[model samples]
Target: MFGLKESEIATLITAVSVEGGGDLDRVSIENRFARATWSGLAEPGDRLAGRAIQQLGAARALSAVVEHWNTERFAAELSADGDPVAGDDMRQAIDRWMPRLKSDTALIALRQAARFGARLLIPDDELWPERLNDLDWHAPSALWVRGTDAALAGIVDGIALVGARAATGYGEHITMEASAGLVDRGYTIVSGAAYGIDGMAHRAALASHGLTVAFLAGGVDRFYPSGHDSLLTRIVENGAVISELPCGSPPTKWRFLQRNRLIAAASLATIVLEAGWRSGSLNTAGHAAALGRPLGAVPGPVTSAASAGCHRLIRDYDAVCVTNPDQMAELAPLVEREIDVSEIDSELRISSATPGSEVSAENVDTVGARSPETTRLIDALSARSARTADDIAARSGLAITAVRAHLGLLELDGRVTETGRGWKRVAVAKPETSRVFRSPSTDSE
Candidate 1:
């Protein structure tokens, strides 16, 4: 649309438009265009784009989004020939190259984006959200947007609701009621499209006839967690599903974590309905707080494991405590909003190197490098003090023998010195090499 015959050039424009100004920096523009281009062609624009991206990194690419791209900047930096051969010659050379992809593949992406009930929204477009600029290098190239464009028209009124995929019944119920209530109050709901809470929220919003948006961790063309394909189809017709990645990218764990930040940043407020101490939803909450968005958590029953994270946030992090939709909707803004934290003291305070940081199952020694089952057993025991093998097995969903084997390893590692009574996880000063063996979960805690 911007006079560049190459689709990558057009996509580059979409990426650049997210920023506020219209200036184009040929170098940076070329870099972003190269990343978008992704073809085998050896065009000059592609070569230049690659060099810029290599020099700037994804972070810089994100910055260029909101920054003006200046053609004059290109003119000032040209080589001595005055012909601008290095720069101008490259631009001319790119014109000689064919558009990178097969027409069929390109058409498919466009058609799928449309059929998915999504419109390709570029940065310069009227409907683009200015707040997305907050993401910096993390910002999207272009958003495949669905649902009513009118829903996005009102910027000040959207809310993001997110939580676990393995949601408990209580979590799903809370999501449904809160999403419905939020919609009733004229607030658009935003979430991912995973099972459990995310799916529940989107479905509830649809049921209530409220506007909702789903942000995916992959391409707009290929929906990950394929079970949600039909569910997503409904959303495209009734709400929106968006992605910052190019069309057809697969959803990886890293992408999923990255996607949460968008959910938090896109809305005025973010409410974490239910999460475990380790649920990925907390990543969204962290993003919300960092961005200075209003953050709230539902008060779950104290005994419920799913609510443990929520309780921790309200008690420790000072997240606004919400009971129902009304409380969530009317959360009083704290002048100095403290972060809500569900991080458990036991989880945080325990040390892998400490002498007591060990558990003794019947056969397994689980102190150091082992399977996930072993890790799960250790975490369960450490979090709750001493427990029988059966209890540990039930909580961790591991075979009894596997749990026992991990316990044996922990004892041998000396990371978990055994007690006649049972085993416990503790911390101790350790050698530098030993530090590498520590669990990441322990470090985060």
Candidate 2:
């Protein structure tokens, strides 16, 4: 049960940390290492892992499990922390995690990832995709990503294009068009990197020179469906290939199902180009529906079994019937708008309007009237990059403690958002912007 010293653990975490090998403070290093350890110890979408980490902090929760804490101690600790779980649940969770609680294995994964230049992203990293949080307790403990910063950030505009692995000619054709068209319109293509429709989608996106992200069921170190090795490699070079599992892990049926949830959640929308009644792509669609994201289905020949799933979704699941890429793009909100201070309606008020003016409000609730500290925090935030609270504090001249507190307030008001281990400013509506709203049912001119 003995573990690495704090300093040694910090070194390993910093090696794979998405902050790109910068010195991290004691608290952050411990937390990131703990999350990476948890990712290996628990299966993807383990609610107890998330809940325990939420209540006890990753480092503390990991320690409790490593020490073989009794059920009573576990329940008591969680209860005192304000979230009480039954002893039976704690006992089961501890049992489920203990078998895989190999600290050495986590160390190996970290080293392997460092060798491959893979990044370990905890919830606090700026590269972490925030939409995954929608999965709540089932969200991944950490993410293993192999790609550039821009490729990862492109997730904000992602739209999932999923379908049957045994895709038909018609299905591949639809996927190609949808993928390329969406790319042309500034969408990032997302998929599981499987054959048929998923492959076609990625290929089309790449052909159009657009960003694409693949969510793997296994480690980013090992590409699944070995035949697609070249395709995934290109993705790593030009887009991103991501996973929740550690470096040496292999793909399994359950992991694939869990991986589908990520493809659904990370994307702004999910479109099923082709599927059979029991197709795995349906799993992705179900996750999309559960998340309340826009779901689109491409229609095909009535006689084709591959199109049955799409029909089922349209008839039974209320999925919008989308025939073309333009229709599919209509599934999500166009973009995150940025507004000029002068564009604030009279009620919102800029008593004195000026172009590109920054307003200062003492009240945190007031949108443009940022407090001195909040103004400094926002000024420190970049629309294109995410910064950890530590970095934000250093840049904004606030203490790390204060930076975190203000971030919570700012996040609640839609002023800033969490990405992996950092934060980014959310773009408000820009001034003098003209938008033509189009209904999904409307025909393209």
Candidate 3:
């Protein structure tokens, strides 16, 4: 259906729209189909694609690709409209997207979603999680949600609870108490649906008969950690299981990292119950901090390694030290911070094309104009400790060859160091002005 009539597209899209898209006007139909197409074509957090959609609008952006517009042509079009994307970036983006541009892929995703009784929520939907807009170019194009609309809507008040998969009893207890307490306080529990703290958060939320959301790295159709299938099913029944990818996508290391951005942005704040230094939960916490979301971490026994990341957050970042549910609840935003965030983003956008742009943690890696792979690889590295290529590969979910290539390039740039043991990230000094990040709301079920 690459060149299908608008009506034809709507027929497929409406099948997965909320209440069969009572609001599916001609423009809405085209945008919905285009975004669903973009969602499947671009990986989550594909900044260039996000830029394309932001500048060109989803429908026209899709048409640009369909019309076989090359980088030069796309850049001219974007430049003429007052947004100039560096040519090399545009070339790389189009190169990656072209191979995945099967005419029927969006159609398949829409059809599969329809069969699965899932709804595709675009930014225009009333039920859309507006807070995610704070992510700007990193925002998801569309979300595939399998559950009640209430569950999706509840993200406004969502508070992400993330930590290690191998949680200690102390961690699980804290999570259970915090999640259930938050539920009692009229909040929706949000987590990634992983083991340990995440699972406990969802389970406690459900046990309390509170709403919960599980944002998946892959498609809603397939549950990751197959062990969590039944938990996910319950989440779908009592809350929602959501994903940015289309029906057939599988969870990978890269997608999981990108997926953390959604969890951090969608929630008003995030709490790290427990995590080791290298735990994936630290990635989520980083996203939360970058978003200027009020981050809190629970302190575990000082001797426990699982608590090291939480301790790191509290010590190194502005993360609040929250112990119980009562203290955790205080971290929620008192006012919507979207306007403040938008203003900071506007400044960054205006300043980005210039040299030496001052970037806050919110968009530090992105504002520097790094490649996505470089950004991911950098995120996978620890500045405090060296790691072998195999460890980096496992952490980044990148192939060993790809990891080595990135490492080599990074080493040349003096961004990482190779110790005899492994590699360590080179810590770069930030400008004094970058200390501030423009920083969000409540959810109900």
Candidate 4:
């Protein structure tokens, strides 16, 4: 009906239906086409478009826009069905939507997407991430994906690692470590396909034989950061490249900001490996925090200006200071529960021993119970020399406050002792020895 022959319409419908693995009836096919049209007509994160599709079906919503129905008529029609979008907002939305409407735009977008081997994913698709629904009215109208469906679904267990495009060597190194670590821990990596930290995260994850998804600001067919063309191609082979924009659409500044929300929403948590004070990666962190997702920041040297954003998040935004993959994985509750409970229980028991008492090999078996932060803090301390909190913080790449807190816990656990110089790690029993401890529970034995 939108300037397409019957055969053309059937082809478009079949393309979407086949990718979705569904048998589309007449109504379902029209609805799929309407959503595809909406993807082209509206910008990403357009709440009015989301609301329209949610209230009226996609087909009815497309017809209302294409038929040039005025706001008053549209409102009245929708209001009869108890829709809440009937006032000045609806009028403004129509104004914004009308100028972009073209009879052939959607059909061309569909053809271009097919040519690029991309699939159109609507909300009904099984591979569609249910987490995106958390965006509410800002969720994408549809996703244009160029990769495996399994890789797309892998995003549910993914961690978003993002940072400044002009990343420093320190930033890239930390990104590599965190990305590979998370992958080893059974989490997928998610990031925008930009240069710097994002590229490194994807590369590291792929090198570790893990899936990584890149969310683009432009069409999936047109990967941004032309330098990463080869990187994006590899991701498409092993993972996925996805976006809300249809084929032929170029990336814009506004789209890039909107795209950050998807990166934040799709992952279990968001970690800023390295960022500057005004880096765009901070926008993704903001979205993650707003969505109530766990947020982590890797601390960098205080002298490095590139890490100012991470410090800001640690000091001001309540973002946890994560120095390694073990810490990063803790940001996701699912991963945290899997990695923490048993280990922490074991550590707590070991730490509860009498102060100055020797820990046994049995206690050493529970060494994994220590948090990564605690481990790093201990590593920064020396048994022969006491160091100040600031020195330890600098060595550990942790916030001073965090270093002090860990020191306090270690002091109570007898793992460290406060001296006139500062603090020193206590010489716990070596793991090679099988020194036994007498306990009331074991007295009968």
Candidate 5:
């Protein structure tokens, strides 16, 4: 752990992710290096390939062993010729695959975090959530933590609340109530820190002066959806904003989906207040179900599109249906506790607003280089599938020229790519059906 601050560790792992030298892919390599380093089996100077072989000598964790394999032609040539070093073929393979992570981006990012008072949390650490290991190789290398230890203390006793970005009135109400209730019951609320449900959950938790954690898809220092930057800052003041990615990492679509798994696994349970059939919240729920953890959804009206995902979970996936705080707590097997709601709400209102109009992708990047229109377009696109120039304009409520201009910017950024006729969000989920209102069938949206 020496000389390996959270950022340095991230850079080192990124260095190991060089691909195509052997059979190893960047993702697998990052996973292997993370496991080995945190397990105290590897150090910065040790020949990574050799350490990988040594770490896998037991053949116990097959996934770890398989990751270190090398498909280099040189190694194969040696093996085919019956070389003496064939006994150490795995080590030979590791050497053959050593040239991948020569880039300095990872290291630079690490330096930034160190300068910012941020720390990294790994699986073996006391703060690490054992549940995250359920993700196998897909689990994060380490969590970039920005906040007090208390924010992460009750991770095992937390619950995640996630839903649509353009949340309905009912959805917001449910998120606020659920967050407040859970906190009042002494449970930490974990969320993505996006707009709508995610924002409401964090705000409510803060209002109650309760522990809350925000798991970002980007770096600990980089808040995605720039609109929530201030909100995230507030959370980090008392709670935390964490990510598996290194500091200065951007919020790519793939990272968001990948991070959702962490949110689901880190908590004792997950709740969806409002989501459409294709919402990313479902992705988190899927991770929870795969881990065999208790899954819960607030039943929205069957007619309301935003409720589609929640309804699907209840009907098809057998998620526990909860309507209110009592029902939600019952699913978690908890006893009731009293709290001063007025004090928490009052404090939250006073501390919540920080003079930001909205959060957009322009500010989401660690670089803060994307424009506000580009952020708006991405936001609108993120809420739905491939949209035509006209469709984007209509849905985003922006001028046609503005939509076209933003779309062009997004395409150039590689955040979005053209899909056949129009354009589609790259590496991100298709947008969910928009919900204008909540129906009466469900008590709350």
Candidate 6:
């Protein structure tokens, strides 16, 4: 159907499905091939395409698009089947998807990806991160993965560490410590494979003999940030380098922003090591917070401009001020069971024996250790005037339920008080404390 012989199509499907460890029937093969076509045909996070595929199966959706049905006809077909897309939205989607429609593009992409030893991972695949399904319509149609299946499995328990590409020496050092510590505690590290903090995180995890996955904005075949070529190569050897795009696709600004969603969704938590006021890492943090995943940020010197983004996250976004591996580890749920008794004892010895192994709770409370929702509620509150829950919801962009929950936490923290009118931010002195450092090395950084 895509200008390839039936035998060739079967071979391609087999290659992609082999790693998934599934027996594919003829129907399954065609569906898998259709999804590959959709991957190349649509941009990442294309809601129109996602909706169509969800309503009609991938194979049927591709047929509907390829048949050149007019907007009115397509809309009527969808509406008859109880789909919500119609009129201008349908026409716009058809117009956008038409130009990329090619009979042989999917076949070519599949062959190219296979040549580079990449596997096509669909939602049904065993190694697929089920967590990504949480993204709903924004989830990828298919993933181009390069590396061990075992490495891909690590993603379910992974934590994303990301920050500014132009990170300072301080940022690199903290990321190094955090990455290594997490690795020692048996958690996989995930990052964007960008320069600076991202690069250091991967390198440290690798040095610690830990599995680390790198999510790329472009195709898995071509690593972005050309300077990280060797590093990415090593990652593919021990960890996986993955992308939602097909081979030969290039990274763009929009894709980078969209890519952050995958890193956040795939991991159990996301940590910002260092960032400026407008660092792209904040976008990652936003996605994590919105997804209800735990988010963390490392505190930098109050004077260092590089740490401003991290500080902003703590002050405004309710990010936990994670200073050491232990604090960072706390962000992940079910992590306590993952640690070995021996490892816990070893960590305690190191924390007690080492001069600066632990950062006190007071040190970590510079921005207040409330949940992100609490921080948002506090930000929405007025110091002098009481505001109702509905008023707080409108201002904080939180749902009424979330606002109430956060208000309860804030009230318990003594940071807010309820009045006849509503709630008011309580004026209180934040205690003074020293910055927490994990060790002498981190202190120097």
Query: What TM-score does candidate 5 get on C-alpha atoms?
Result: 0.60
Write candidate 5's Cα lDDT for 1-445 as tens digits: 2223544454544443222124544444444444433222211112333333333321222233335434453245334434324445445334322322223434565566666666656554567767676655345545677887888877766888988787899899998999999999888899988778999999999999999999876667767767788888899898988876666555644456556777878876678899876676777777765665567889887789878878877766667788887767655543311232122222211121334422111211221233434544564464235667765553333456566766777778777777666877666432223232111111010
Q: How well is each residue in 251-364 modelled by candidate 4, as lDDT tens digits?
A: 654566678899988988889899877567877887876676777889999998789878877776667788999887766755443464233222212122345332221221
Q: Quantify all predictions' global Cα lDDT against the true fold.
A: 0.57, 0.77, 0.78, 0.76, 0.60, 0.76
lDDT of 6 by residue, 147-226 (tens): 88778988877989999887899999999999999999889999999988999999999999999999997788878777
- What is the overall TM-score of model 6 with all chains considered together? 0.74
lDDT of 4: 0.76
lDDT of 6: 0.76
* Model 1 misplaced stretches (Cα beyond 4 Å): 1-118, 154-156, 332-445
User: How far in Å is the alpha carbon of 80 misplaced in model 6?
Assistant: 6.2
TM-scores for all candidates: the values are: 0.56, 0.75, 0.78, 0.74, 0.60, 0.74
| Top-scoring candidate (TM-score) | 3
Q: Between candidates 1 and 4, name the one with more favorable lDDT.
A: 4
The digit string of per-residue lDDT tens for model 2 on 102-209 reads 558788999899999899988888878988988888899899999989989889889999998878899998899999999999999999899889999999999999
lDDT value for candidate 2?
0.77
Backbone clash total, candidate 5: 6
Ranking by TM-score: 3, 2, 6, 4, 5, 1
TM-score of 4: 0.74
